[model samples]
Target: MAGRRRTKHRKLVDKIKEDQRVSSVPDEQNSAAADLPTELLERILSPLDLRNNIRAAAVCKSWQAVATSVRKSNRHPWLMICPKVGNSYDFYDPGQRETYSLDLPELKDSRICHAKDGWLLLSKARTRRIFFFSPYTLELIKLPKLQSVHEAIVFTAAPTSDNCIVFTVNHVNPMAVAVSTCRPGDDAWTTIIFENQLPFVSGICTKIVFSKGRFYCLSEPGWLGVYNTNNGIWAVLSVPPPKCTEYLPPDYWWKGKYMAEFNGDIFVVYTCGAVNPFVYKLDETKQVWVEMRSLGGMTFFANFLSSHVRVDLKGKMRDNVYFSKVLYYGKRCVTYSVDRDRYYPRKQLYDWGEEDPFQSVWIEPPEDA
Candidate 1:
């Protein structure tokens, strides 16, 4: 009986210890989340969208650090509105329908020429100074003063990178264009006059995109010009202009066009008042423009200064073209669906030509910002 009693007591003590360990597991798991390894945290948060990634950062300081370090390559673009009277700029996020304002005295009297990789290439007319600015980090990089204002300006990459190249082109004459190239650390821009073999008129309304070491300039009349950065050869592509004139209104046709490049494919969007915008992709192999009925799960953000393309967008955002215009008292952004063949929240009757080209722009935001 004494031996049996001792055995029962041992079993009871073991059961009690087992119960205690099970109860502590929940607390341990909660603590482990806060102390997770940086690599593991990055892996977990890297795939999340910008909104969720920002929300997760508020969980703890460790999470905020990890979120800041993750480079979200496919994040959505935000619309930045430059105020005419003050230094306060408003940024609109389409996904969240939220407007964020930031006081940027650095952008006072400055005009944004182009935006890519969260950096803005701005030109101040008063000072004739050209520089790069990051709205999120408030970082600024200065460039040499430009002798003449080249309205068509674009950069190859972020200003911080060694591969970053700033390019601009303007009409010197009907047959020639002044092409200027500069790097971030350069003392001055290198200007060259390239004579066009064909009729390619470049002006302040021209749009440009850089892809695969080449600069593709789309003239105001839809002519395509190609410049090979590697060999310094400039040629006009034989591809004909997209047939959008018939569908566009006669008054504001020139101001309604936007261009973007994604995965080496060039896309052009043509907008019409109260109508679905037409999308066309350039077939370089065939040297022709192909009208696209679908974006293949890609979303395009269109702006006068710069445009961007993103994939894997969620909900009603996929396969849509979002314009820089905000309507309904700044509560809703104008968006159009190519598949549905209609605009969200009804059609917009606003004329694109009347809008100020520099008043609003699409800017890529950093992951942490």
Candidate 2:
């Protein structure tokens, strides 16, 4: 009786295995897709914008299967020039490790800023006409033009997560302040205007920059204005280090080299051929301005406006206060990144040997993944 029961159990197991094998079938589409060269396939898809690239992947089972795999790649994010082509774009995704280009409607000729999240700010690089969209969602938002802004250049001074675009406008004069952004569903640039003469009467045309949550600008009148983004008001109230009575022409300031923001604070380096350059910090909470001190941890910021070290658009750090580099220079037109941060000290992010700065270096937005 025991032998007969064992035989019956063995037979049952064999039958189950047979049935399972018969039920499964091969996916021909996926199998065929696996045969194509991935580089060739990516080259085919790489020109599409963030939106239609997904759409092309959804075309057929074979293409979809291949495209799906392409989308999963983890590429490092990079900063690249944005192109407005074919009434659309063929952007390269540094994060994908490979690029797939797709169509972006209504973006032709509109200037584009860096990609953030999945969205791009589309605008006339010179005028205020602007729009925003996510290449993944195919959602487009139009913005209201700043009535006061007749012409402008887009500046991404806000935090990486914010979609708002800022620019200095010629409006009627080419040097006023203007801001615009797409608030979710809005279809156009929502323009904001700021105007007030410099407070103390200095001759510099200071450009506005965003650090933390405040907008800072040193006007031609030699006054620094701190505008709070949340409140939309200028606290142009505090004044420190009075301007010299010896009057210099307004053009003398030459739009001070951008104030670099690091670890949530702003530091503007003063480097000209004429005056001993010093960095000043704004204590927005207390409404006061103070020069960064050498002993108090900010000493590398030493260059005067009267020296050759101060050129058209060049600067350096005098200490570790701005990420710890303590020194940097513009050799190929690009300001070498010198992280004063305690980690890597003055490591080169990009290098071009013996090249004229006119063709080699440029300031750029930090890449966001």
Candidate 3:
């Protein structure tokens, strides 16, 4: 009887241990999630925004593996500002109407020259040391020192790319402009000077944009200066502004000029204080500027600080040109209808009569951030 009892007790103990082990196993749903294939998981997480995607990544190891695989792209442009009251900068999303703050000690002392693809080209006071930084990821890349590039700078692509090219332009004189180019891995900058025979004023603002694998420098007097990145040749292009039957007004040449690429074509925009903005497209084959009556589905955002960028018509922001009204004690955000020739002033970005000193810039946050 005692032997039989011992055998029964051992069997019960073994059965209890087995049941406990089985109970500790994960549930069906969790097991399925953990065993979910990476391909399907990526598809599920692909539509999440940067913030939600981060939360999804923290769910579990399998979710993280899949979240990291989702490609980052299709980012909208955000407006960035560094106010005088704080060390952190504010990023405003136009679509969401939300603002995000990022702590960047590097930007406190440095000045921003250019912003694109979520990367900022920052220069320290007078030392000529430049750094490319991503505010989202806090990644930093030191660029070659450029002492003469205080006017305009442009990058062909993201600084993380191996074949990226950076171009800088400095107006040297009334008739001459100095340009510099450098690759990401280069320690020094290559300088090129383009001088025109005709004399003009020197202090006029300049703008640069990268399109069709070349750098287009739009300078004062409405000239398209072309620098072929592949061939390393510089060409000065003179495309006369719209024919003025009457004597051109004083603001004719003094108007604000900017360049933007839309639908693979480059355009020059002329904005004056009280006149309707003008648009001209480059007829590459004929080497002339063709007046554009309508922008179709494109919109333009121009401010006092950065280059003009092309924004596709979406929702309420359609077929309009947006600019900041910073004159006459005004700080209004105004949009112009290219088709209707009307100005619609939206809410002001700053308080009325308060002079905001920071240079406003639009930046496309990196997808991979």
Q: Write the per-residue lDDT of candidate 1 for residues 1-369, one digit (tens) a residue.
A: 999999999999999999999999876765777789888998999988766777888777788889867735366888999887989999988887888999999887788999999999999888889999999999999998889767889999999999899999888887898889999999999988999888889977888999999999999878999988999988888888888767765666577889999999999998767666889999999999999999878999988889988886656688998989988877888888888877876744655666799889999866885
Per-residue alpha-carbon lDDT of model 2 for 1-369, expressed as tens digits? 999999999999999887776654244554565567768877777665434556878656656666666553222222222342354333332212233345655655665432333455555756656665555556776666644433323344332334554543332232344444334334554556556453333122344555666655554544566656677665455565323312223454443333444455555554332433345565657755555544232222111111011111112322332211122331111222223222123244321111221111111222442
Point to the candidate with the largest TM-score.
1
Q: Which 10 consecutive residues of model 3 have the lowest summed lDDT?
A: 348-357
Candidate 2, residue 36: how far the Cα is off, in Å: 49
Residue 295, candidate 2: Cα error in Å is 11
RMSD of 2: 16.7
Put down candidate 3 lDDT per residue, 240-264, tens digits, no spaces.
Answer: 5444212335645644565676556
- In candidate 2 the C-alpha lDDT for residue 340 amounts to 25
Best candidate, lDDT: 1
Error of 3 at 81 (Å): 1.8
Q: Candidate 2 — which residues are off by over 4 angstroms?
A: 1-122, 125-127, 131-144, 150-184, 188-206, 241-250, 274-277, 285-288, 293-369
Candidates sorted by TM-score, best first: 1, 3, 2
Stretches of model 3 off by over 4 angstroms after superposition: 1-75, 173-175, 195-204, 242-252, 308-313, 324-333, 346-358, 366-369
* Every candidate's lDDT: 0.86, 0.42, 0.67
